[model samples]
Target: MDIINEILSSNILPYVLLGYAISILVVVIMIVLENRNPLKTISWVLVLLLLPGLGFILYIFFGQNFRKEKIIARKGLRNHHRLNNLAYSQISQLTHGSLGDNETARQPTGIVRLLLNNSSSLVTTGNEVTFLNNGKDKFEALLRELKNARHFIHLEYYIFAEDRIGNEVKKILKEKASRGVEVRLIVDDVGSWELKRSFFEEMRNAGVEVYSFLQVRFPLLTSKVNYRNHRKIVVIDGHIGFIGGYNIADRYKEGDAKTYGIWRDTHIMIQGDAVNSLQSIFLTDWYFVSRTELTDPKYFPASQPVSNKVMQIVPSGPDSDWPAIMMGIFHTITSARDYLYIATPYFLPSESVLFALKTAALSGVDVRIIIPEKSDAFITLLCSRSYIREMLEAGVQIYFYQKGFLHAKTVVADDKISIVGSANMDFRSFEQNFEATAFIYDKGAAQEMKATFFKDQSDSEIILLPEWIDRPYIEKVKESFARLFSPLL
Candidate 1:
């Protein structure tokens, strides 16, 4: 006790406090030298000045921007070599008038070219797209396909919780593995932190190879924490695939009703050559996670042209040369002739997307966006509300979903294009996380997506400009405060 009192009374406490203050100052200076986006830099600086301890922790986990780093340099090029060839071949064929009699291909050429130039996303002309709305429909389709798996089953998701839905999936995977069908799974380490080691051990025991994406441990959490694989992809026998925003969790796809009503989401099941593109994405990520490059003729079975639906599985992340999905959305908005419709749970748009929406509306294009009235995140909802006034002033119409949470990320323009995927309409989905979007260039598909949007719109409340302008002063101030940290969110 006397020793502890002496230490507390000594000058060591002051020295420790001085050291912490200096550390915070050094981090702020380092952030400035990084030359990140001006808004993000200012946000970090203000956060540090206000709450030094908590801000530093949040920055370490979520704020580090590694856009200039090439972490996966070696195997990435070799893994994507075949897809790159396909992308170039498609570009050449389109350039030389090979698409002689197809008007569907001509309408989306601008966005197609943007994707090809930026990310080598191949435009697959033969695809059968099936849109699945809500959790029940998607899980039913997924389980049916899984039961028919013959050769291999590949699954990846941001969250693989050990819940009712997850256990159901694991049971199917184990049964498949026991029958000599190769089963592999990838789950994000941070997203699936609630999953215990024993759950994975059971899968491994049953011959299901499970690995976590970007293993997060002490001393390496800073670099790996910010970039998450938010993609949810499932490829069965290299012939059928699924991609969308639904994660493998009870809250995502368990039942009909919950604290938030039914989980309204959208996913697509694709059959034909387009599955090869989704397979390519899965193999690339698998190589990164497990380091086992599975490149064989069996992994990509020769697929025949099924339907005339043109589609491209576009992916974007920190490592991309450009934000392919974001740019494609912007181009669609700018090129919309009649109308632009969108549904997203989050509405924190980046500067370019915000500008495109506003400009399109001002130019006489009908722009409508629907967001959930009750969101899972309160702060995010507030930040989203902060942008509604400006959008309304620019003649953009906004709707609030009243039935339940609107967890679907979709966009349909001029009834000519349909986009559905895991990426949100926020900065993180476009700039920070690894995401995927399927661009279907078919009027039929677009009409179906548009119909779903209308059904949800019927269940929503349209917010008028005057009603929004007359919001409570305290609420507006709260949202304004949250808007200051939009980039971080």
Candidate 2:
């Protein structure tokens, strides 16, 4: 008892106590001043209280809110207000003119208006959209487009692996740069951290301008680590563009045979005025990183209408005050009069999205969601299962793809509206990552997406409510525990 007393009263105890007190103080400050979601606040507090020393370190890296400061800086650099004014002017002209005459625009007007107003995503008419179902097709088409590049090539992705496919793409990029094509590439530092500086030296030596978004010097001590650039965009000479869930990696290609089997995904190739919007998004991000303004008319060359497909390139990120992509999806679900089909790798949605989906299902709308049977993140899978019962009970049909891992983020509503992008049906995509989706107002595009969803469904196993409820008790407990971390996940 004497020894215990002495140890408890040792000088080391005071330093330990001080450390814990500082952690507690930080927790209090976060709860009081961060203005985060109540659930997230509780989650962070719980992590801090439970993990003690390590929790505070995690909080320092992930919990600090630098969005407002970074957003203000980006706004000042990009002149966002001028872009907003231009978008608003375009919206006014479209609203008063013959935009409603097109059936594609007549439907989903509210969603279009909301994106235009909130995200400054101007609706562009006359776009041709082609769906690429897998990475094989996507990369093939991308390579062809790269081979034909003339003036400039811009590419951005969350993951640009230094693997087989990545090397091939790099070879093409180097060749293009060598031919005076002005190639530029941006990748997320954290996602592609495996890539060494030497991996990019060859490209740099060949005149390719490479930059990493929000590079982390110290991975465990940086606030920027939480926010990632998740968008995958490819623009060839400002006339052709590709955007969707694909990254430059062999794992995305079919026959790569990952642990989950074949990889299934979706991407879209765009030609016409919509490519200009995609290029603008790339330029905005480019300016943020490279600090070289690219507002010349050469990059925004006039595009003649190729098709009747109306498109709005809606970009969302932590930089924005509102979750624009989530809001657009919510509006799409609420406005659906016939049916809604969704395919995403992650299904952990926000409360508003969950409410919207449940409301839509209960309103007699045919709502269906497809998720992969085996996800890359096991914790996210566990948390996703926690919501399966609720969604099933609400009459929302849930299907788990069995043929392969489904990484496509797609939605087709009422056979007249479609969305394809990098933003998943999850809070991380909505609230943290820089994502972009193409709001396509065309029955042809919607039908193609719906057909793809059905094709994916042919290989999926539907989860019945009774069977989901009868899952093992241990699994239920695991799900409950995982759900507690859903906000943070």
Candidate 3:
């Protein structure tokens, strides 16, 4: 008590307090200068002022704009030189309508040009895309492809658990690597941190080269922790590829034992020229991780177009200069003449996306969105619900999936555009984490995606405006509180 009193009453206390205030002011000034999302900036300011101690720590970890560092810029620009000519030539062809097959392609060719100019996301045709509805089907297909990987296997995932499914996949990777198939894996350091190093070591012993994306060591955890590589990509021999929301974990295959019934998810098994793009994305990340570029002709083997499916494997993140997927979705929504259906686990959309949805709905475009009734995160669920009232007011139909957690990040715009990938319609997906989505411009594929959406819709319960407005005040309070963190979520 005497020591505490002496410290509290010390003559230097005033100087120390002044220094602390100055420091906080300095941080606030930095946040303002960073020019972050206005909402995020305001949230950070409030946190620092209201809870200085905790907020400062949180700011130190997440609020810092790592984009200014230019490492991600370098990573993003690596493909520019190579893709520039291809993009330019394609843009030239696309502008004249020689690139597309039919009038159905006329509408979304704008999106193709946008992606081409923005992200070098080339439009590849004759790619066959098969939707893997759940994790079980995804894995079965993935394993089958893994077994047939004759040349090389490249995989990048946010989560690669050390469970039954992980072991099974690892076993195949080991077997392939042993046969000189050149297997490589990138698991997000933080996402897969639960497993012991030995888990990966076992694969290493079997000759599989494994590395982590944005490895977060003890004290250097900040900054990187906020920007994750959330993409789930698997390229086998540059001919067969897989991309979607399912990470390598048991819960995705078997139902979430702790949460509820089947953990419903969506993935795509792609076979065509699009595989080259998928391969390129994996190699780019692999180069970032291993510093060894795999640009051999074997890595991107020549693939004959398997079908008439036209698509672009769009990639985006902090590494990207522009929010490609977000912008693309905005354009897609605005261009929708008929109806647009979406399925995503998280729906904390950026301002542009939210505006796009509301505007599209208001403009008489039938916009239907399906999200999990009870998401894995309670706070996230409430945060998602907070946007519902505004959406419902705009006449956008919102449905809650009661069967299970619907973790499919998909957007089907009219009969010409079908988007599916690892990206959720959220700030984390658009602004922070690395994501890759295939924007398919095809009638057959779009129709198939619509059919899938309708099937899921049948199982979902729609929210009417009256019922949503009449919800209990306590629930609204929880959602209101959660909404404050939407930008950071």
Q: Which candidate number would show the highest lDDT if scored against the true structure? A: 1
lDDT (10s digit) by residue, model 1, range 1-489: 998688689989788778879988898999999987787888888888788689889887878878668444433456588777777887887787674247445757878878888888887767899899988889999999999999999999999988898899999999999999999999989889898999889999999999988888979888998888899999999999999989988877753365567778899999987898888888888887787888787998988877878888998887677788998888889999899999999999988899999999999999999999989889999999999999999999999998888899999998898999999999889888888899888999999999999999999999999989997899999999998899888
TM-score of predicted structure 3: 0.96
- Count residue pairs with overlapping backbones in model 1: 0
lDDT of 2: 0.87
**Model 3, span 1-489: residue lDDT tens:** 998688688997788778889989999999999888899898888889888688889888887877556445444434545666787888988767677566425546778889988788987877898999987789999999999989889899999998999999999999999899989999998889887889778889999999988888758878688888999999988889999999998989997756767788889999988998987788778878887766566776777768878888999887677888988988999899889999999889888889989999999999999999988888888999999999999989999998888999999987989999999998888888889999988888899999999999998999999998998899999999888888888
Clash number for each model = 0, 0, 1
Q: Give per-model TM-scores.
A: 0.94, 0.95, 0.96
Give lDDT: candidate 3, residue 419.
94
> Model 1, stretches more than 4 Å misplaced?
1-22, 74-77, 99-105, 254-258
Candidate 2, residues 1-489, lDDT tens digits: the string is 987688688877788788779868867685769788887888888888888778888877777776676542556544455668878886886687645345444656678779988789878877899899988799999999999999999999999998888999999999989989999999999889999989778789999999998888765446788899999999888789999999988899853464888899999999988898888788888987888877676887888778888889998997776789999999999899899999999988998899999999999999999999998999999988888988988889999999879999999999888999999998889888899999998888899899999999999999999888887899999988898888888
| Error at 275, model 2, angstroms | 0.8
**Model 3, which residues run further than 4 Å from truth?**
1-6, 73-80, 100-107
Cα deviation of 332 in candidate 3 (Å)? 0.9
